[model samples]
Target: MKKVSVIVPAYNAHDTLARCLGSLVNQTLQDIEIIVVNDASTDDTWEIMSRCEKQFPDKVIIIDGDRNRGAGGARNQALDLASGEYIGLVDSDDYVAPRMYELLYEKAKEGDYDIVDSGYYQEATDTARLYTGDDLTGILDDNKRKKTYCRRRISCYQSF
Candidate 1:
């Protein structure tokens, strides 16, 4: 089984999907699985996912949606197919750092926590700003049965 399942519900996100996927496949946590759901996109989102799967056969899983399921529905489908000990949901139009999953996973293993998450940067045309700053390390010892969040100033990893 995969260590982490990264789910992406994409709908006509051809313009940014490539970069979002690029970050996933290149993650430092190589034991992760990437689930890319097409969500019936009219654009070439499927084509991009196809190429990604071809390039990373053991890492990328592509789902072709017959109907236009909204983001949450698409995520449910991918979640059902996921075979990971942990899961990460990402937007198709958003990209993450290479070490994003690695940091979160390591923290989860260290604390034996349920849900770990991190903060991300909001990209603007002229500038990028820090958002969701939470220091996940502070709450590492929280109940393993409950969700945990980490926020910090830097954008590397929080708790996810």
Candidate 2:
């Protein structure tokens, strides 16, 4: 089984952290580690995290930062501690489906891709849509994507 590292960068996100972590806990794929970067939160983030850590002691790894690191720096801290073959980034405020990692990991394993951007759907009250598109031909080719998005040719709304 392939192991995955799910990294979460948290600041004063006590309100949403539980919901985010709840989603991760219910994932179908069990071979994963949850890395939470506590970016010096002044709220009850650490308290909530303590309870969660006790509940999932074997699976949770909390990296407490002495000073507040921005999102990028917190993610870097988690990356340095990650030991899994695949690394996943999950914002502390956003929740994902239970099969998110399972499907992504399967696609990565089957396609032999160094990076795989999977398809997603927007769940709206009045509408829903399926997205299909060409993958990035190369990495760091901002001009190509920027031009496509700027020309209003991109299908997705968040085209950045």
Best by TM-score: 1
For candidate 1, the per-residue lDDT at 62 reads: 99
lDDT of 1 at 44: 94
Off by over 4 Å in 2: 119-131, 135-160
Candidate 2 weakest ten by summed lDDT: 151-160
Which ranges in model 1 have alpha carbons more than 4 Å from their true place?
125-160
Candidate 2 lDDT, 57-145, residue by residue in tens: 87788888889988779989988888778888877876777888887778778867555544334444334444334544345378755
Give the Å shift of residue 118 in candidate 1.
1.0
Q: For model 1, what is the error of residue 142's alpha carbon versus the real structure, in angstroms, after optimal superposition?
A: 14
User: Residue by residue across 30-98, what tens digits does model 1's lDDT show?
Assistant: 899999999999999999999999999999999999999898899999988999899888888877888
Error at 61, model 2, angstroms: 0.6
Query: 35, model 2: CA deviation in Å?
Result: 0.1
